[model samples]
Target chain A: MSVDVLINEVGPRDGLQSQGKTLTVGQRAELIGALVDAGISAIEAGSFVSPKAVPQMAGTNELYALLPAAEHVAYSALVPNMRGYDLAVAAGARTVNVVLSATETMNQKNIRMSLEQTTSVCAEIMQRCRQDGINGQAYVAVAFSCPFEGETSQSVVRSLSDRMMEAGAGKVIIADTIGAANPRQVTGLMHDLVGSISAERLSCHFHDTRGMALANVLAALNEGVREFDSSIGGLGGCPFSPGASGNLATEDLALMLESMGMDIGFAAQRLVPVVRTAERLTGITLGGHSFRWLARQVESEEQGGGA
Target chain B: MSVDVLINEVGPRDGLQSQGKTLTVGQRAELIGALVDAGISAIEAGSFVSPKAVPQMAGTNELYALLPAAEHVAYSALVPNMRGYDLAVAAGARTVNVVLSATETMNQKNIRMSLEQTTSVCAEIMQRCRQDGINGQAYVAVAFSCPFEGETSQSVVRSLSDRMMEAGAGKVIIADTIGAANPRQVTGLMHDLVGSISAERLSCHFHDTRGMALANVLAALNEGVREFDSSIGGLGGCPFSPGASGNLATEDLALMLESMGMDIGFAAQRLVPVVRTAERLTGITLGGHSFRWLARQVESEEQGGGA
Candidate 1:
């Protein structure tokens, strides 16, 4: 199939999980509902992780129970191991995204497993996903650069990505966990990745830590990779990666894409209010320099001033 | 001369001028001193606008008097008109930057003059600069999009840029006053402008309000336009164009440029402390997602865990 751009809203999962605050299952359901209304067709609803580590993602099953099923929207949960996969499947999650690191150091630091062990665990999860008839999306975190292991090699990224693709995984997401990838690196790696793997079955997950998420997205877009993962108000920072910021703000990414004449279904204008809500919810102000300017443009237009 | 990169540090002038609370002369001098020590060769030290309109910039002459004279550092000030130019020259400013709007509505809102009137005034200022042997740079604010006039055409930008270049402007910096210009539009316009004008004589000042400043910079860099105006820690907002945040952060821009193997002298590692000091002085967050990440990277390396 041709590359069809997909925006996977990870607000409810990656966003809330990053913040120390925990929301009730009902709140996660409501946030998901808001996203569905906003025309986001795919969402990483929740992550099945140890509550000891991330309390916000504790009641993933309960949140899944509360989610309103829609025909168009594909809701997925992050499953780290076979146990997480089983739990996600039992919660009626049709899609499960398994994550592993390419480097031994990062794999050890993130999940206390070596690269080989992590890959083996992911293979088991992928087998479980295939047995349960659930679509498995594997993500190789720190595909670009790692805090524990700097300068993640493109060959390693490609090797792991190929492994996941062969292991009954329906798709793969390349994540720059530490936000260290520049445009040249992104363009070069993406060009190679897309040539080897179908860009349609690939997604790019970026952290805005280095302020290069949007630029990286543009690079991937040029390479014909359609799917992207962004958090509302840029609310998701990596727990393992110290000082790394959240994903790219959905509003900011949508604005850039829409301005470039790429038809992302979400309306960039409507997202300003939601970003304000997110800002109020979390005192951390998100977005690049243009957030307030675009807000003013929308506000002035509403006030009948063509600003 | 070989390819030289000019970084016009605007934090002191454009940044402090827009804030509600004005800094003392000592504090302003300290800020400039820090930037100069950090290897910024050109600093927009202050603006000679009216105290009533811009109270923060009232001590332009005081700041100029105390500035440490260095052979490499070129101190400039904003000159709105002939009176402003005279004040700037009297204050010992060797380089004065003049501002004029391309559209009539913006000109009316900004300085209460028609485009023709503004052009005539700018021409007089240019003639005075020529006679006085002072370098005058013209900034075409709202060159990409006008808040009051809506979409600003490329023809207007080209016309204004050509006139400014012809009128003794050593360099003409194009301001995205409302932060609405995307990569394609900026690239396309720069392509057109570069054909008529040397990229060396051009600079781009972009606001990150739409999260496209870095991408826009990448586009301009690819076009061979090296000179750029950025605020330290992303200080300053467009006072005339409300809701537009600070120009792209100097550290962020330097980080990208340095990583790309481009020889821009400002070190991204050294800029963090400068940003922290500025943020403390200004009482406004010098915000960027990458700031903390960079700090952590440094700290981790210090702890023997290289990032």
Candidate 2:
């Protein structure tokens, strides 16, 4: 099937990292199974972070080993530093991701490092991944706004994104860590980024905290971005980031894309059951804004109600 | 105050008409007062229809008479026919609107009239508004997709809109009656509509049932639409129209526009209390997707926590 956009499901990593309940490796594997069944090919499976720091991501390595080994399925995990990158590589990970905060205060608060130090460490990880023949990706976190520092400098985000790309990162995901992005901001930043680094290597991660995620996605898509990061059922946000309410739900993104006559490689309505499964496993009442209308679509179809 | 967009509030009419509980004319006046206080300049006060058929709008004439007589606040009303139009003008209405369903099935089902009959009636009303020197507007209902007839013909919408304009309608509001519009469709149709009719005489009314309302708004905004119809707190949809769900909330639209540095003539945060008043009046939980984040901004500001 032809795919117009590549959606990297991040429920297993970014979504779970901020969750209250820690799913066991087995439970995490179950979630992945449901996502694959719904026609997801690329996913952020887990992270190589410390179990003590993020209990929700504790069993990432074991979860990776248990994930489906389908040739088309691309599973990636987050690595904060060299040790984490080594653990990820030892666990048979083919793709490794590193987070590079764009602001000085965000770096200090998140990883107790200066912006310069975090950027260097991330660049090193990306370089290592390239040497080891791994698909290296970097996230420019808080690319839009910092809760403590107000609006981030556009030039700063631009410089760091260029640095990550220079360090052999195959892709740079611009992440709105605090969900403070609006469409105009997304369009302006995406326009500059796509022009400089090119759109083929760029993706966006937006939060629906202010109900502009889908709009942000549209702006980026218009600017030629072909990939995005979404969570199943709008699962989670960074625990350390205030007001980063919900990740853009996979169902919402998929439905909007498909409804626009764009192919996403699956029937968007089929994800109704997958959202239910996510809710059951995590014990969290979850779904995107479009979940109810999507569920009704499945119901109407089952009862033979014609469009 | 400078205004980049003209928001015609429909809560007093469309918002209350479908409610489970009917508000007295006095209470509806109170809701309008709240909207006006929040910097709303244009409002759809109510409809001059058969009282028994729509009891919620029974006391519209009385309500209009009681409303504030501020020169800056432009209020409008809906009129179904010549008799309704006369009633509206007699009630001191300076602006009047009429609904012209785009699909045959919708016309038959909603008003027991053929599409041609409804169009003629609406055209006559617009013509009359011209002779009377009143501001006339026509709504092309279900302009994107109709529930009973599936996709509405774009050519039919274009021709009818032109007819209404020729007959003296000052503006044509392209309404997504069932909340089924996508950004792709919106962009394509709006491009043609704006090109043919020019952007100055057009507006859009979107519903949030499928979570693409804001996206649609952005698409239309890019096409040069400077007017929109919104309901306070996402108050109501057509009771007769299935799947219409929630009207685009005024607060959500205002916030997104303001965040993008566009002037919407009011502080978006000030709508928090307005939404609360709506909830209190209707006895329903209401707010757009941005409501939570908007509330938090207000809270943070009150606590002197600088953004």
Candidate 3:
């Protein structure tokens, strides 16, 4: 059976935040515009965290102001707390993404909040989002494994997901923050998740640190997960994890899905120019494992045209 | 269910042949000895081709003389014709690997022989191998896609496989020589293969040209095909396909398989030293997509030990 998958482009927010080279708001807008032109419907355009903490995502509000409001595109931003949520709402963000760490140690390390404190903060933000007619998606970071606390159990993730849903989250994304997961782990965790949560409201965000991101995607697809988070040119990595690679490249994921006869709403080849632009702006060599192969295809095409 | 998988290391034969620097016979022996110590049972140690043709494989006879014939190890050599097969027998190779391309263009370009001529030669070699009481494994190169031929039909591969087996090949390896096959293509081809040929007599060799090798492995595993061909440090690309990456790394394959609860007879961590040696010898940057992750693990282990 043919499937239509939703690819949420997270390059502007998740990808840029971890990069060393910071792009200007105009560059971010250009990247987003290219992605929108390529038929990406959902875009995590920016995050509302403190500029002092993350300088790369500092001018997201200005980026939002400069962006064109496309008819089919849904722009979202990451909000860490109630203050950030207010700032996001003021910035004209219609959809907000909130992240809560799955482990207590991770919560302590990342945002310096206990699980109870984080849950209350998320619930308050979700409640405000509902009242303001804004969509809210909760991301459970380190859902698979944590670098500090080690193996995270599925039960912990499930309980956190349940609390987020109760707190008015419309969607929940399970993230492998450190990229330490295997396909069997994905199959086991997603099998349990699909039974408790509907596939419509569940998504997966994977890091390609261990080269299993696409394999994990195949595993999740077997469990009926249709929504995935990817970055253009594979531009993001966890700030806490040293020497880790970026997120799975959007071009690689798109290529695999299209090859499998699944429709992802955009032409995979159209993203090559976008990837090149990202590489130029960020000065980070972005491309997934299939980057060289895609570059070869482009080279061959140009030569063919020249001939 | 606990599954035992066979990992055939092909760095010496397949990897070295494509590399720029040629390792001495002593270095080749040392690499093979390390692999044997790491519990790799089957190894394509060398080829019996002319030194004038492939200088990298020169002095393989001397390497065989220096190697200690371990009880569990099987040292096989690639034999392209009757003369090469005779050399392999003289060198005390108990098992010989014979190759025939699936596409006509690949056969003509690679071996300078037509499909019919290659088949007859392979059948003749297999028949002699049977008389000599030696094991024979036939490799169907470019079984998935050929660089010269756009797409190779499964029917052609199937017919060639039938002919090779009829002529006394004990095992058959389906090779994606150009590393152009995706998971869906692997699933489709392997599904038919597993039904026609017993999984016991079938193996898969994949190159990582497009970064889908491990994903294709997962697809083949789902089809009950267990044996796979890997090279240390991910060495060995197709000599015919320029700009292509090496074969699937033995360390990466071992890591994924062991993590998935499959017993491959040894620890995946044991292959790191072998990979380092391969890098030093071939001077080709080895290691697959998970190279950084594996290196980090090694660092952590060393630090933990010092503490």
Candidate 4:
């Protein structure tokens, strides 16, 4: 049942950020604690960003401070710039994720920086992470299609990925931020990326906005890229992208992968309680495609011993 | 732009039959008319089952009578048995869909018959359709997993498919009736099915229960399946299967296929209005994965010339 795949849980960071209400430091720690209990080893706990800009992530450092460090568990934080990276490092973050949009328009809109400035910023972040002995994962946002820029060229994404790697990023995550990627586009990009960058160093981050996240995941899996970023209860969406939906639901992805006989290293049944906790905290009826079905299974189990 | 794929619209039959309120025959006809106008040619217009058994599908004949016939547009009806077949033919149905469960438990529960009895009934119905010069599509429901029986055997599905084809079924649709199929299972079954049956004579019907329907479609497409059954606005789910979600949303499928540059004949843009109409009629917000994104595109077009 060991399927050699890494499910990097991003719910604590990505899932909670876009919500209307913010979870207290204790509440965020509880959610992350539940995920670790459910056997999710890797978690993006929070981001080191301006509280004035993203107030939801204000107490990230305290949230991390309160967390119980465990064996086989890795915690990472998103660092937007040099200051964010410095803050993350000071907060005892051992791994940092730096993001830059793939297209010029998105880079400008999302980070208020030109593509050149964003890449330069990313390179500096990656170099700092390398110098500080922190694992650096760089993200190419809107890797498939930008909300403002119709289609992103593979060449552009490829060059940016190359630059991030050259600048000492340990891994690169290709993100369909707008959730607009289809399987074929995913295949085309992954096919090229896998050839140029080792599959071990490449991952996929997708939103379920267009309901193609899992499909795109399958495409990446076929290309031998095994690492993926998912959120609990299908939380997270790019605030800048109009009509964008949530991130690929962790429970949904777990169900598909487990059904396919891939050992995702966590019990899908165990994630149900985690999702329920998320729903209670967010006060949103949180679910992915498998949410209802899983709930039914849980109910059946309660009524009849097991699903 | 000419990618060959048959999108068999199943909204009128499958979509409506599962709703809380049944649309009037006039309302059903108008929906079908709108679909036809949107350039969808194959529609499962209604069912010929006992109205007492499935009151939602009552007055199907009248619904058919109200439909406008057009060149290249084929209207089919779901016929449960010889009686339903005869009724469908009398109502001028050119094509008929006969369904048989792949599992013994489902067969007994759904139709109050054993597997042997159901196949015999299907053979008789297929023979009748052949005699009446009607095209017949046989469905192997719960082909992947049954709610009561759990995992359905591939051999059981294979043998039933062979018998249906031998009994004069023009095509056999492999349905993940309870929406329990993942891509690997789909690929395994399709890999074997395609070897035994020509790809042209094989189609796939999937539900998005686990959000893997489109991924399953991708698997089938890789195995050379060009025909798919989709409900407009993701409107159908099996009433027998507790907590089952809707059929693979036509808009979602069309978006994926069309984005891959496949000529799905109809534009994804046109399906937006149809989905809006479906929402209006069902008194439910209907959408696929790309529903919100597509709606935004339509809105932008209205404001700024056209998309």
Give the TM-score (vs. native) of candidate 1: 0.88
Model 2: lDDT of residue A281: 90
Docking outcome class, model 3: medium
By TM-score, is 2 or 4 better?
A: 2
**Each candidate: chain B TM-score:** 0.94, 0.96, 0.95, 0.96
Model 2 reaches what TM-score against the true structure? 0.97
Give stretches of model 4 more than 4 Å off. A1-3, A238-244, B1-3, B238-244
User: RMSD of candidate 4 to the true fold?
Assistant: 2.4
lDDT of 3 by residue, A109-218 (tens): 88899988897898788888888899989999999999898989899999989888888898999999888888989999998988998888899998888778888888
Please report the candidate that would top DockQ against the real structure. Answer: 4
Kindly report the interface RMSD of candidate 2, rounded to 1 decimal. 4.1
- Candidates' DockQ values? 0.45, 0.55, 0.49, 0.60
Judging by TM-score against the true structure, name the best candidate.
2
Task: Give the DockQ (C-alpha) for candidate 3.
Answer: 0.49
* Superposed model 1: Cα runs more than 4 Å off: A1-4, A49-55, A123-133, A238-244, A272-307, B1-5, B51-53, B127-133, B238-244, B294-307
Instruction: Give the Å shift of residue B187 in candidate 4.
Output: 0.4
- Over the stretch B49-124, how does candidate 3's per-residue lDDT look in tens digits? 9999999999887888977689888789998899999888898888999999998888898878999999999999
* Candidate 1, residue B149: lDDT: 81
Off by over 4 Å in 3: A1-3, A238-244, B1-3, B238-244
Task: Residues B2-23, candidate 2: write the lDDT tens digits.
Answer: 5998888999998899888999
